[model samples]
Target chain A: MRVQAAIEVAAPPETIWELVSDPARYLHFMSGITRWEIAGEHARGLGARYRTLMRVGSAEIGGLVEIVECDAPRDLAWTSISGIDQRGRWRLREIGPGHLGERTRVELRLQYGVAGAGILGWIAEQVAAPAVRKNLRRSLQELRRQVEHEQARAAAATRRAAARN
Target chain B: MQAQTARASSGDGHAADGDPFARDFDEHEAGERPPAQPRRGPLERLVDAAATVIRGRVPAADLDERDPDFIRESLPAQWLLASLWFRGEVRGLGHVPEHGPVLLVGNHSGGNMTPDTLVFTLAFSTYFGVERRFYQLAHNLVLSWPGLGFLRKYGIVAASPDNAERALSSGAAVLVYPGGDHEVHRPSWERNRVSFDGRRGFVRLALEHDVPIVPVVAIGGQETALFLSRGEGLARRLMLDRLLRVKVLPISIAAPWGLNVGDGLGHIPLPAKITIEVLPAIHLREQFGAQPDVDEVYAHVTATMQETLDALAAERRLPIVG
Candidate 1:
């Protein structure tokens, strides 16, 4: 099953990049992306791997994954080589100006393979497409909300701090 | 007579026009002529003609100077949408106490610095009925427009420790966007992407002023504005791109990027709604001089801001805007 969902992030790409590209900060922003620990010694850059598990409703699905690409604040893409037939990519493209803040068009693309590689794969793709798309959409939106809220909080702190100085 | 009987508009009124239904008929008091049934039009019979003239036909430019929302909504709201528009589902607005001077410290994105500030100001004014001016500690460039006209007009002083002290000292509700330039271009969507290295400004100011910090979490506001790609070098050929504080991209990214000055900022902003939740006021008394570790206070406040944001995202419906 292949599905894609994106969220218009008011945050700058750099802000989103800090949260999404860092393997350690996954739990800090994303909602259902659980079980992100190192698979090896490397923590950042390409070829670094992480054992990952994502929560889908009541079910938990994951596999060992390796980073194929990592471009800070711009692109982070990965493929599942050992898990339950999973593929994930996080892409940040400048989409135009945002409504309230600056907007970064965040596209999260995922492809899932069913048990069979042929007809059954097609069936599974249809069945899982909506579910996975919905999940990814919600997750990206969650990430957006978290960053912007933090942005506001940071602003307040700056104001207060500036006051003292 | 108009001055003696004239009433200052009360509450957050829409406008001063009397309801047409409020027309009265009482010409018999001064004349042998029977009074005309007070038709809702101009009655040569009364003294409120001035009020009526000031009513529906009132010019937006003439609105009370302190209440800018009227002028904003009346004349500029539509035009403002031509560039960018925002719709925030403000939650926990009541957490902002209406009693005394309160300091609102919040996270701000570099791509869209002023969104959170504007939304917070509207929410506060709408709920509190006071035209509370949120003193913004803006950058020097934003104030130095042309010859610093905009700043002088709107009363935005530079962001400094002294300005913060002055605003808080005057018992006014002030707001600050602390992320500065770095936070603006940071990671795309991470909430805790980066920390303010020397971020003790708010904490120190609050402790010094003895004011409570009202922590606000503006979630998903950054989804609307975007920074496509940064240039290879920070060239210093200053112009409008730098003036507007947006990077000059070689390629167009945002929806309205190619549009002109009057085009409706195209619907690139997905329907993801914005939810602004006001968390409990964080008190500085316990650790002002007690904790002694400014780093500890910064970490604590930062964590709280993140926690509040996460909770809101998990619990509330996501937002969608212009």
Candidate 2:
């Protein structure tokens, strides 16, 4: 099954990517994520691998995943190296202009299924879709909130610095 | 290992009390057992032959029979049952070693259906992908049951020390329930207890193999049915211990067959929410002396498991609703 959740953030794509690309920040924003740890040497870039787990229903489901596509400030995609077969992508686009001057549209897309699971697999996918989709949607909301909050803090800090100068 | 396997094969399932797998290990280990049974009638002889034939049908513990592909395919079905019906929640899986031969000792419950086994197997397989070699020791009768051969593909072998040694030697995590049939068929009132029935063979197995022991405690399986009694007296009177090596003829009030006897055919387990906690691994030599006393280790293991089971029991606001 495929699930996607999107949100508009006040910061630029670069700002959002900074949080999404880093494995360390997943627990801070990703809902239902129980674990996300670097499995190999590389921490970032296309070849980096991470051991990931999300609590859905009765199991902490996920496995080693490698970053397949890591385009800075725009897109990052990962595919499973083991465990449940899954492909995940983070898509970011710079929206023309909002009240906040510049905004980024961030979408988290995930497709997961057991390869030869047949009819029950189909049913399980459908039953689990809502929960997985909710987690993604909440994760994006949390990401947007964090990014926008940080931007507001920086702007305030800049205003105070200018006044002091 | 070969000698142990040979001795293990001598008795399919005829151990005395406190012996897991009903094997003759206790007789060999301690040299004390119940006296030999008297001469048998024609009916008793026939029953013994039938049981022998059934026991002969048990497949040899070939670790190669574990089919990773088959296990992967069947996981969805197990997931559905565990998620929707049992509402299984497994915690502390990280306590199991990342990769190695570890002994997972769990408390058995839910009688023949064994919902805990179903839930834990799914959790473990999903937690550590299907490629990892993992085996679970089951009662001889379960393996001998007709139409249940598919279980072997899931890496289930007959409960025997030699089989466990093979799985561990191959560096696969082996799961064993020291309680076996005795505790699994206990009365429901004692559901919250962790009763291994004074079995310490698991500790010896771990010490001999030099593997870490991880205690897996689970609750709510007993609520799956209204277990009335283990029927030890009845089984003894019927000579089932001699003929089939079955120590208990459990009686319970279960669905599809009220006042169910034997539970031989199994029954539909109630939708009881199962919660399993995997305790941190215990390195026997590290925790105890280099040459640990088997009795002391057994006591410590059972006590730790009992404490965990108590905590799990305390968390339940209701029985099956948990």
Candidate 3:
């Protein structure tokens, strides 16, 4: 099953990138993910792994997933190494200046397939599709909220500094 | 830290010159006619989202749902008794997972007034905090008692596959006594023994849910009373198993009620200095093969618990002392 969601954040691409680039911050934005922790010593960049557990209906599906692709301020993708078979990607695009100025468009895509269960796997995928889509949309919404909130705080701080000087 | 200091200063209409951002923020704040509402950070937002998800996913009828206020209110009394009266000492709590579903299998002791259950429950809830989901499976009759709303509030649920499944599905740490009434009512002479009465349901529950099994071995509960026998024959002849789902009609000697039979009405529990030790989690797929045999898993769990119980028993210098 494949699920995709996107949200436009009123913040600079660099501002948004600061959050999405850090694998540890995924827990702050990811929805339906019960557990997301760095698997080993490597914290960032390609080949970094995370021990992830996703809520699928009544049960939790867990796996060790590694970063397969990573491009700062642009794209990040990961594929499962063990347990459940799955892949996900995050794409960030600078959508130019908007009403709020310096806008960034963030998109998330997830594709997953259950292995070896045959008919049961297909049924689970079908059942899980809606939840996966909901999670994707919620995740993007959360990402946008965090990026915009940070931008507001930074802007306010900058204003205060100018006034004091 | 910088932001926090800046915010604190700005609230007082003063900005520290050390931070350039603090100066401009103060002017922006002063220029605004209306006070700005405090903005919740990403961490706070994430916590709210998680709480919402848990509330929505966990069923209203879920037996494992905990009332934080009630648990908090009862903690003082329970803790005092556990520490002062029983001298209850719990070890190996680190073996339990900080999060995620887990099955805690332990031997039931002290018949109807199982102090082991109380001590462990109090300790577990206190350590994990009341917000974390936890459930203790008990016989249906226990839940049938009137005016015991406190039990249900504390996440005591009727022992059944559905209840267990619901609790696990909701990602609760479920504590199950596979031995049930039979093990709890065992003769006083078998105090040091680890007995689950050959029940293997707990093994299947862990495998089916793919949760780690945490073994909790407790001693000294049997010393709470002088148990004569499990009264299995009496229970069988009376068809108590079929009617009440009670497998034992225990005979025990206790104050107020000497030669207490059935212990259905409850008895005052002797402060036997209960000691509970939790062992490392046993992952079924890792320990046993993927397609693990039920008997082998059962034996492994029971044997491990027995070994730990024997060790704890050996450490005791005298009855009700340690």
Candidate 4:
């Protein structure tokens, strides 16, 4: 069984991508991202995997999530390895200009599989899916608040700079 | 777009209560949506066309994006204006769009189901060059009211999947509440702890129909005419809430900032100028190409809503919080 959740945030792709592209800030936005760090083996790029721990309710699972694709300010995807099955990705698009010039639509998507190789597995997935879905949305909303707040700070700084000049 | 739709593998539409898409009330309620007027004589068609033209020309009230006037004309201004005492300041006239279909999805509020929406529409009509209809995708219960013929006429459509899909595809900017009514009724005022479910139908429609999604956040909406309790069990059963389609405070209850009953509408709040921050657009990933996985589609859209909301909130109390 696979579960997914998503929302549109109102910051430009560049503004949002700056935060998502960085491995340093993953936990700041995602609620269940227990452990995350750049793998010394490779830089953040295609095929580069980052080992991280995630929580599904009380249970914890650790996995090496590899970046299957990475198109800055556009698309990013990852799949879990050596842990509870899961795959997630974030994609940003220029939906067109938003209400004020500052907002852009960024869609973040998360998907996970229960690895139900049998009936017992299926039963476990039934119990776990809803909780994970809620977690995914909560995580995404956090990402939105973080990114937009960061951008607003930048915008305010820019205005202040102009004022000083 | 096809790829994006395929990627959105959300496991929704399963439960009766959980999935808005699968929210099938009953045959009687389902019959409440629209099928448009039936075929008519050439003169009748001409009359309809002329009416559309006239409504298009009339100065409209600034309503919420999903106010439903996208399909028909029912912008209720004189009524709400007469009811509430609005004396708030307006500063961002330069921000609203001058033309075209605009989506006005603001913070869900205490101004009844579509009161603030109607207020927004009225303001848009007053300020913008052309009077535009702000279509609001309201809950099914509000649109299902009778005295509210004013309801159907003003284009307040149900928030069901099918109705929302139809409204947007027909060229209207569909306004939605991922947080739904629950967000407005949050018990504490310490900033809502909420996120939208994996309902990507609106995002898919925006991609499929190719309309821009604007993020609107209105401050002071929930605080006004406030109804804060999340009534449970017996209090709810006899609270006259369901019949009203909105929660109401007890007759004797007072508000936080020292308010009492016996006021004009009881919960009718003191006049306040609601400032709305209409943030920039969330450009649908142009590459999604019309059909992408549902998961991917949902991801892209949800992120934008979250980001926009935060930006609006941060910008709400500008000029220093002294």
lDDT of all predictions: 0.53, 0.86, 0.73, 0.49
By lDDT, is 2 or 4 better? 2
Clashes of each: 68, 1, 10, 73
- DockQ of model 1 vs. true complex: 0.01
Q: Give the lDDT ranking, best first.
A: 2, 3, 1, 4
lDDT of 2 by residue, A1-95 (tens): 99999988888998899999999999999999988999999999899999999999999889899999999999999999998999999999999
Q: Write the per-residue lDDT of candidate 1 for residues A1-165, one digit (tens) a residue.
A: 667888887778888888887888876656566567787779877888987765442223465778898887788888865645567788998776766667798888887653433554354346545656777878787888888898889879999999999
Q: Residue B72 deviation, candidate 3, in Å?
A: 1.4
| Candidates 2 and 3 compared by TM-score, better number | 2
Best by lDDT: 2
Please compute the TM-score of chain B alone for each predicted structure, in the order given. 0.60, 0.91, 0.80, 0.55
What is candidate 2's TM-score against the reference? 0.94
Q: Across residues A1-165, which tens digit of lDDT does each residue of candidate 3 receive?
A: 788988899988778878877877877888877667798778887999987766544234556789989888799899987655689888889989988899888889888864554554565567668877998899888988888888899899999999999
Q: What DockQ does candidate 3 have relative to the true complex?
A: 0.01
What's the TM for model 4?
A: 0.40
Ten-residue region with minimum lDDT total, candidate 1 chain B = B1-10
Docking class of 3: incorrect
Candidate 1 Cα errors over 4 Å, as ranges: A1-165, B1-85, B110-113, B146-155, B191-198, B228-252, B258-272, B287-292, B315-322
Range of the 10 consecutive residues with the lowest summed lDDT in candidate 2 chain B: B1-10
Model 3 TM-score on a 0 to 1 scale: 0.55
For candidate 4, lDDT tens digit of each residue in B157-255?
A: 545555555565555545666445444444425232223434445554455555666655544444454444544343345433222222333222324
